[model samples]
Target: MTTITKDNITDSLLATVHPNGNSEAAQVIRENGFPTTKHEEYKFTNITKRIESKIQSFQQAKPLGLTQQDVSKAMIKDLDADVVVFNNGQFSAELSSLGEGYAVTNVTNSEAPFSIKDLYDDSYLALNKASFEKGVFIQIPKNKVLDKPVLLLNLVKANDGQLITPKLWIDCAENTEAVFIEQTVSQDEQAYLLNGSVEIKTASNSHIHYYRVQNQNNEALEVNNLLTDIHRDSTFTSFVLSLEGDMIRNNVTLNLLDSGCEGNMYGLYLLGGKTHVDNHTNVDHTKPHSESNELYKGVLADTSRGVFNGKIFVREDAQKTNAFQQNNNILLSDEATINTKPQLEIWADDVKCSHGCTTGQLDEEALFYLQARGIDKKQGKALLLYAFAGDVLEHLKIEAFKEYCIDLVQKKLGTNF
Candidate 1:
C-alpha cells in the first residue's frame, strides 16, 4: 500500500521526485499538509479520499508513453490550428506546431521564474510548484496578434492510476490579441489523478480568449486551477466546458489591477452516470472603472451531481465598477442533484454588482408543448436541453468549435440533429 503521509511524501520527493534538490514548494506542501473537506473552498469535494483511492493504482500503471495515432481520434477534426501536445505530463515538441510572434519553451530551460509567493494561500498550487516534472511557458510580444488559435492537447494514457501535473505560464504583452484552447483526453478507459495549474497575465490593452475543454473518460479525476491578472484596458475571457469525467473541480481566480479592465467567464457542464463536477470562481475588481460578467449552466442526469460557486468582489477604491453573475442548472432524473451559489461583495458606493442562482428540473409545460407539436417525448426533451445550453455555445467566437460542442450535447442526450 502506497500511502501519502507527510513523512512518506517528503522522503520520496527528496529521494526520487526532486533528486537534484528539494525545492521550497515541496517543503510548503509538507508543512501545510493535504487538504480535507473541512476546508471551506473544498467543502463539496473530498480531495484526500480521491487521492488515496488511486495511490496504489498509480504505482502500477504503465510507463509514460504515447503516439500521435493514439491521440488523433480525440482531436478536433479538420481544424486548422497551432497545436501543442503533452503526453502524460511531458511536452512533445515533435507533435506540436509552433508559429511566429510567440515563443513556447520548457520551464526548466527557461529558468522557471515561478515564485511560491505568486500563489498565496493555495496549497495545491504550492504542491504543483514542487512536484511538476514538465511545464511550458508561452510568451506573445507586444503589438502582435495570432491569426489562428493555439490548441494544447493533454493526453493521458495510464490504464492504472497515475499522477499527472501539467503547468502552463502565459504572458500576453501590450496591445496583443490571442486565443488558447486546452483539451484533456484519455487514450483508453484509464484511471488517473490530474493536478493542473495555469497562470496568465494580460498586459495593458491586450485581449485573450481562453477555453478549457474537459472530455476525459469516466475513470479520471482532476483538480484544475487558473489564476489570471489583468492590467488597464485589457480584456480576459474564459470559457469552460466539462462534458465528461468521474470527478472534476475547477478553481478560477481573476484580478483586475488597473482601470478600464474587463473579464468574462462562461461555463457549461453536462454530466451523467454518477459524475461529479464543481466550479469555483472569483473575480476581484481592485481599481476603478472595471467590469466583469459570469454565467454558468449545467445539465445533470442519473445520479450525477453538479456544484457552482461564483463570487465577485469590488474593493473600496474600485468606484464605477459593474459586475454580474448567474448560475442555472437542470436535473433530468429524480436522483440528480445540483448546488449553486452566486455571491457579490461591493465596498464601493458607486459600484453595481448583482448575483443569482437557480436549480430545478426541466419545465414540464415546455416539454408537453414540444410533444404536442409532432415531436416525441425524448426528442422534445433533448431539444429543450439544447435550447438551454445554446446561449453559452453561441458565445463561442469560433464557429467550428461551437458546432462541435453542439454535437457532443446531442450525443449525450442520445439524439441526432
Candidate 2:
C-alpha cells in the first residue's frame, strides 16, 4: 500500500468541492497537515498509518441506498425517540422522522459557528469541514422541553474502502431541555474510514444530554470529534459507549464559558480481538462557580489495546471550581494493554480538583469465592465485570436505553445478566 502523505491526502479531496464545502478548512489542512505518532496528542494512537493501510482513497464514500428497515434494525430497542438517519455521511429524509419542538436545516460553509482558530490546528476537523457533502443543523427553541429524545443514527456502508465524513451542529436556546443519542452503525464488514465531527452549543439555563454509541465491526475504523460550549446556569452531560471496532479514536472537549455551569462525561470501552480504542477528553472551566466530572473505564481481552488521556483546566479567574476525573481499566488477558493519563491543571487556590487512574486484572480471589458459591466461572467473571461497569451505566438518564446497553454489555461478556 502507498503511504498517505499530508501533501497528497487532500489532493483528490480538494480537487472537487461541494457547494457547501469550506475553503478555509481546505487551506488549514493544506498548511498544518496530518499528525504523526510523534505528536503528543496522538502519541499512543498512530491513526495516520492505519488510515494509509485501510483507506484506499480520500474521496467520499458512495451511498448505500439504505431504507427504513435498515434504520429500524439498527435502532435501540424500546427507544421512544425521534430519528434522524445519515447514510454514508448524507442525511436521509426518507428514513428520518421528526417530532415537535425542534427544527432541522442544512449546514453550509458560512453557517457553521466554529471559528477559523478551532480548525487551524486539527487535521481531522478541517478534513471533515472541507470534504463533508451534507451536514445537518439542528436547533431547539428556547424554554421548550422536548417530549422525546432525538436519535441521530449514522449508518455507514464502507465495503469500498472509501472515506466518509459526517458533520453535525446542534444549537440549544436558553431554558430548554433535550436529550440526544448519537449512534454509529456499520452495514458491511469491509474496510473504511469515518472522520466525523459534532459541534453543540447550549445557551443559559438549558440542559443537554448527549450520548454517543460506537459498535462497529472489526474492519471498521473511525475518528470522532465532539466539541461542546456550555453557557451560564446550564448543564451538559456526555456518555460514550465504545464496544467494537478495528481502530476508534474519540476526542471530546467541553468548554464551560460562564458561571454556574456543570459538565459531566462518562465512557466505557470493551475490547476484544485486535481492536484499539483511544479516548481523549478535555474539560475547560473558564468561569467561577463551575464544576466538571469525568470517569472512563475499559475492559480489554485477547490482544486488544486501550488509551485514555483526560485533562482538566481551571483558569486563573475561575475560582470556586470543582473538578474530578478518574480512569480505571481491567485487563482480562496478559496480552491486553492500556495506557491511561489523568491530569489536572489548576491556577486558582480556592478550587477543588483531583485526578487519578488505575489498571489491573480482575481479582482472582473474588472470582474463586464466586465459583465456590455455585456460580460457574464464566458467569462469575461476567458478574464481576458487570459490577465494575455498573457505576458508569447507572449514570445514563434514559431507562430503556440504559437497559439496552446493559444487555449489550452482558452479551459482550459472554454471559447473561
In terms of lDDT, the poorest run of 10 residues in model 1 is 13-22
Model 2 bad stretches (over 4 Å): 1-7, 10-20, 113-120, 159-161, 415-417
- Cα lDDT tens digits, model 1, 22-138, are 366667666766567897777887765665664443332223566667667667876678888887766789878778779998875126644323424555666566567658999
lDDT of 2 by residue, 1-417 (tens): 233565565565454345677887778777766677887888888887787677666557767878788889998999999998888977887889999778987776556765323412677777888778778989999899998989999899875537888889899999999999998888888888888998899999999999988898788888888889899999999999998899999988999999999999999999988999999999999999999999999999999999999989999999999999999999989999999989888888999899999999898899999999999999999999989988999989988899989988989987422
User: What C-alpha lDDT, on a 0 to 100 scale, does residue 7 get in candidate 1?
Assistant: 39
lDDT score at residue 132, model 2, on the 0-100 scale: 80
- Model 1 spans with C-alpha error above 4 angstroms: 1-24, 57-63, 115-120, 159-161, 415-417
lDDT of each: 0.80, 0.86
Task: Pull out the clashing pairs in model 2.
Answer: none
